[model samples]
Target: MEYRVLGKTGLRVSSIGMGGIPLQRVSEEEAERIVNLALDQGINFFDSARGYTDSEAKFGLVFRHRRNEAIIATKSMERTREGILQEVEDSLKALQVDYIDLYQLHNVKSLAILEQVLGPEGALRGLQEAKAQGKIRYIGITGHVAEVLEKAITLGEFETVQFPFNAVELGPTEKIIPLAQAHDVGMIVMKPVAGGAIPDKNLALRFLMDYPVASIIPGMDSEDQVLENAAIGRHFVPLNEEETKRLQESIKELGNTFCRRCEYCMPCPQGINIPMVFLLDGYWQRYGLKDWAQERYLAMKVLADECIECGTCASRCPYGLEIPRLIAQVHRRLGRN
Candidate 1:
């Protein structure tokens, strides 16, 4: 596997580490198989969070027997002293591990949240106490927002920072990555595929690997997905100049099929599965997995059939996506079934 230095933590993580979100939807046995396959294939770094329902708990089942084999990174968004301590204890118990390799403050969505985390009675003190007690090896901070992440790193001694770094979201490179590199802090890239919206997975890996981040973690729930992600690590070759130019061109040239996962365009008045519609739309439009995507799209219970044309989702969307139009498109394509 191609290993990169995880900045000052002095840990070498694979080019593609396992993201822990998809485990929420999978069975314990299924998660075990997927995680074990990744480890067997040289994925040592496993990232999880307390909020990802049953993810850490499911991982605990796998790690119980292979605790010494993998690097476990988990996070909590809790920003209280007692809550932080309790979260750490609960995570340790859930993972069945004595300590976490990396403990992160998850998803500091705003500058205010960042301050509250480092402020008095915040999670920072609790993290320090946990580190003092040898409960966590390193401290990391993650966020989808750029300003908050930059502010978090500027004010604290975070060893790692996780942010969305993909073809569409290059904000981190311009915002927090350089600062993290300057501070010798690791960058754990999340949503390399924009939560599975990006179709060319290999290209996505090559794109992220071009930058000097610690590693990129993509969620894998099945053996095929595990093999698919681990393949990038096993034979990782950064994009060539021409390939890079081609990728940039592709990004600029995209006519359709990309979901930012901003979730701003939510609360669809029609109960028309907007995100899921777009998700399946992306699967077909980008990956050309039409049959599978079509099947899943047809399974939606509260589908595009209910879109009342109120345009509330469109108003809420940060990207200004045409929610009603997209719902109509999904209804036309998949509503019959």
Candidate 2:
């Protein structure tokens, strides 16, 4: 696999790092197979988060023996200094590592949350303390919102930033990326496939590889998928003009339906999270995989079928979306009615 220097940290990271979100979905044995196979392919960067449910422990099981041979990064959402300090200790014990290569603020969602982390007694102070104590190398932050992430960069000196970047979400490439680059920050991409929405995986990955990013973490879950992603890594192809046009067209068609998850069209009078409800809706509608995702949607007690068509959702929607109508359509499509 091709590698790039991870910004100022100077660690050589794989062009495609192993994202840890999906590790929570597999058995320990399956997770081990996937992790080892990734290492065998010369892909050494593995990222995890405490919120990912034993993902760090699963990675620890195999890599603890070869710690020096890999680069591991993990994160937590604790906003308090004491909470963050405890989180670092917990993650170290779980990952079985002396120090994390990069530790991050896990999705500081709002301006207030951002301020809390950067405040005098805030979590970033704890992160700074961890670095001084040899617990973490570089400090960073990750979030889905470009503005929030840009705000994070301005809040303090961040060593790295992990946010969504793909054919579907190029807003970062245009804005957030250049800002991070100017700040000399490492740029790692998360959800490069738009949470599995892009039908052609290699095409999606190649689009990201075209950029000068430190790495793209695509959540490798199996040996086969690892090999497939690795093969592309060895080749490192960029989409040609025709292919790029098709990919852009695909993105345009899938764009607004994809729910950037901005929480903009929110506070549905019927208590629906307009964006989240529509995100699940997109999973069922455009993907034509309702049966595959139906159980998960059904399991959510706040299913969109409860939307009352009070027009409040539409009124508050910055994008001027037809909120209640779309919710009904999605509910009917998912048979959640």
Candidate 3:
């Protein structure tokens, strides 16, 4: 696989890094197999989060032994010095590693959160402390909003910045890309396949390689996905003219207001699986999988129809999606009622 220097962190990471979200769905043995397969294929960068329910441990199951071969990265949602300090400790234990390669402030979506994390007693202080104590090697930030991420990186505190930069979400090209390049902060591209919505995964990934990003992380759970994604980096190529047009056409179909399936809007008090509902809805409406999508939607134990309309999910969403309103629309089509 191709490797690139991850900005000022000085960490050389695989161009096709492994995103940890999909690992949450797999069994411990499956996760171990997938991670090992990725390593065998030369994928060295692994990113996870404290919130991804046992994802860190799943990674630890393999990383603990292959510690030297993997560059482990994880993040936390805590915004305070004390809270983040505790999170770093927890992450260290969960990953079964003495030091994390990169620790990010998970989804600093707004100016308020940016301020809180940069303030005197904010999470940045804790990360700084962690770096000093050798718990983490470098700090990075991830978000969906370009403005907030641009501002955060401009402060020069973060060594890297991660944001969704798929063919549809081109907002980052306007400013975040240039700003990160200027500051020499590593640019990590997430949701390169638009959260599995893009049908031509190979074309979508190759399209991202055209950018100045240091790495592109597409979440993978199965061995086939690992091989497919790793091969993209091993034999990197730009999207040809016809391929670019096809990708742009797909992008046009996926207009804005589509969920990127970040899963930040989770744990509804009413127990709704918000992103999954939207995923099935996308398959039904956009992917021409009406029957298949509807079957999965029916199989869901909890669905969009159960949303309580409390608006808590929207508040947490980085995209500012109207969760209740969108969920209602999805339920109308997918809900058994």
Candidate 4:
């Protein structure tokens, strides 16, 4: 697979690295097989988070044995020095590795949180401590807001910046990408397929390959996905004119307001599965899979109509999505009388 230097850290990583979210859904054995297959195919970068349940351990199952073959990266939501230091210890134990290649400050969505982390006793202090102690090699930041990331990168504290940059979510290109490039902070592109919102996965990935980012990580859980994604990196190609047009058409269909399934609006107080509702709704509206979508929508333990209009989910969403309003629309279209 194609390898690129990850910003100032100077670590060479595969252009097509694997994301760790989907690994939570698969069995231990399955996760092992998928990770091993990815390594065999020359995919060396693997990113996970402390919040993804057992995802770190699942990767550990493979990483512990083949630690030399992978470049492990993980993040934490902890905001204080003590909490982040504990998180690093936990991550090391979970991944069965002595040192993490990259440890990011997870989801620094606002300037307030960013300030808190950069304060005297914040997470950045802990990450710096960890780096000094040899627990982590480099520090990075991940978030959904371009403006926040743009500001964070300017401080020259983080070695890399990761944010959503897909066909539909092009906001990062305006400032984050350029500023990151200017600062020599490696750019890691997340949601390359917009969490499965973009239909043409190959074309969507190919489109991102044209950019100067360090890597594009799309979450994968299966062996076929590993092979398909790895092959794209191995035989890198730019998007042809017709292919670009097709991708643009697909992007036009998915307006900016649709869900990217980042799951930040999760654990709804009312037990509603916000992202799943939108996923099914996309199928109903875009793919003409009304029947198939409706069946799954109906099977959901808590339907969209159950949403209490609490506004809690909306407040948590990084994209500023009107969760209650959009899910209400989903209920109108997908819910049964």
The Cα local distance difference test for each model comes to: 0.82, 0.82, 0.88, 0.90
Best by lDDT: 4
Clashing pairs in 4: none
Q: How do all the candidates rank in terms of TM-score, highest first?
A: 2, 4, 3, 1
Model 1, residue 22: what's the lDDT? 77
Mind giving the per-residue lDDT tens digits that candidate 3 earns over 110-154?
799999999999999999999999999999999876679889889
Q: Report RMSD (Å) for each prediction in the order shown.
A: 5.6, 3.5, 6.4, 6.2
Assess candidate 4 and give its lDDT: 0.90
The residue ranges of model 4 lying beyond 4 angstroms of the native Cα positions read 256-325, 329-337
lDDT of 2 by residue, 140-259 (tens): 998877778887766546889888887766779777888887777888998888878787888899989988899898887678999998888878978999988877777767644456
Candidate with better TM-score, 2 vs 3: 2
lDDT, candidate 1, 17-82, per-residue tens: 998877876889999899889989999899999977799998899898998888899999898878
Clashes of 3: 0
Question: Stretches of candidate 1 above 4 Å error?
Answer: 241-320, 323-337
* Best of the candidates, TM-score: 2
In candidate 4 the C-alpha lDDT for residue 11 amounts to 92
**How many residue pairs clash (N, CA or C atoms closer than 3 angstroms) in each of the candidate models, in the order given?**
0, 0, 0, 0
lDDT of 4 by residue, 300-328 (tens): 99998888888989999887789899999
The C-alpha TM-scores of every prediction are 0.79, 0.87, 0.81, 0.82
Q: What is the lDDT for 198 in model 3?
A: 80
